[model samples]
Target: MQQTVVEHMDRVAEDVVALTLRATAGDLAPWDPGAHIDLSLPNWLDRQYSLCGDPAERDAYRVAVRYDPLSRGGSEYVHRFLRPGRALGVSLPRNHFPLVPAPRYLFLAGGIGITPLLPMMRAAAAAGAPATLVYVGPSPATMPFADDLLRSYGDRVRIVETGRHGRPDLHALAATLPADALVYCCGPATMLAAAEAAFPAERLHAERFQPVARTFGPDTAFEAVCARSGDTVTVPADESLLDALALSGRPLPAGCREGICGSCEITVLDGTPEHRDDIGAPEGRMFPCVSRAVSPRLVLDL
Candidate 1:
């Protein structure tokens, strides 16, 4: 945990604010592109924002936040209460959407989703790698970092404003990419889905801010058996698996409870899991925060 003071807060775009924070004590920890920090806000709400600033700068960290009208209090708090000189708590950086080495890069950003890709573009340019960015937003005012990206990258950056010009031909864009080119997308679920459908799954990397809608059969009570402790806890339909485990004295590590962050992941010793997170397939593990059991009983490693 680090205590930081907001050095500056400015509206970078319509309903989007950029916050610059400086460590109150020691120097901030180093973070790479695509990394995000968990901003602990009032009322125990934690929101994750991508680090958009240069990785070489260790003195301060920069994060851009977009205000959601249907916010669950996180964005509203930042927009309303947070100001210059305000103190806030933040967790160390974590990267699940890491940029891997590739021959070329194609970044597709939508609205404020450009936050994570901004640093990635900088890193790619600094390394002399071939990269292109296609930023899409409803209008010019809603698109953050548009001018800066255009000024820096010139012809390498493309803007697709829905209000001025209709939606870009994503399929056409995806078809033109090279075989070795890596496609990274961060945006709304619809845009991410379009990118996923347009490109190969192996080549497409995405980070989602919201979880996808899932259809589950009626919520039924189930039992989670702990392998190590040999304890069994009944998870009610109204309760999440994470809450049930925590009530049983075994709390799993969790970040965003909305299933955006893969923090409350737990190993499944046996039984299939009904995946509900936006992060996609859980491999062999399950995120207890939003995922629930499909079988009558689930065996977890705990």
Candidate 2:
């Protein structure tokens, strides 16, 4: 954890505020493109925001947050109460949406999802790699960093206003991409679903702000055996495995219990797991926050 002070705040768009935070004591942690830091807010709320500024600048970390009318206090607090000089607790940068090496890259960002791809676009241009960005938003007025992006990348950036022109045909765009080109997308669930269907699983990479529909059936009561402690806990059908583990005297570190954050991931030593997280961790590992056991008994490495 690091103590950061909000050095600057600006309303970049209609409901989006861009924040610049600087460390109070030491240099801020270095981060690469596509990295995000968890901001700890009042009322025990923690939300993740992508680092949108230049990665070479070690003195400050920049993030743009959009105010969701139905936010769960995270965005509302930042918009309403956060100001310059305010101290904030922030976690070290974590990157699950990393930019992989590719001959060419196609970035598709929807709404505020453009935050992470902003830094990526800069890195790609600096490397002299062939890259293109298709930024889609509800309207021109609500889009953050639109002017900066247009001014910086001119012809490389394509703007799609969904309000003016119904949703852009992502399938048509995907069809035009080169065979070896990597497609990175960050946006709403509907956009992600379309991308997933248009591109191959190996070629398409995405980051989701919310969990998608569960493909599993109804939950069932199961037994979890802690491999290290040799303790068994019965997980109720209506309860999450994380909650059941806590009730059994074994509490795990968790953030964003809705399965968006990969904080409470535990190894599955034995038995199958009904994976429910959007994090896409492979087999043998499961997010206990929303995932449950599929077999009668699960042997966890915890």
lDDT of 2 by residue, 104-155 (tens): 8999999899999999899888888899999999888888998899999999
TM-score of 1: 0.89
Model 2 worst lDDT run, 10 consecutive residues: 253-262
In order of appearance, the predictions have TM-scores of 0.89, 0.91
Residue-wise C-alpha lDDT for candidate 1, range 1-302, written one tens digit per residue: 88899999989999999999888987899999999998888657888899999888887899999999998898999999887998888888878899998878999999989999999999899888899999999988889999999999999999998888987788998778888899999998889889988899999999998777768788889999999989999999999999999988897767788787876778898988888887764577888899898999999987
* Best-matching candidate per TM-score: 2
Off by over 4 Å in 2: none
Runs in model 1 deviating more than 4 A are: 225-230, 249-255, 267-272, 280-284, 294-302
Q: What is the C-alpha RMSD of each candidate to the true structure, in Å?
A: 2.4, 2.0
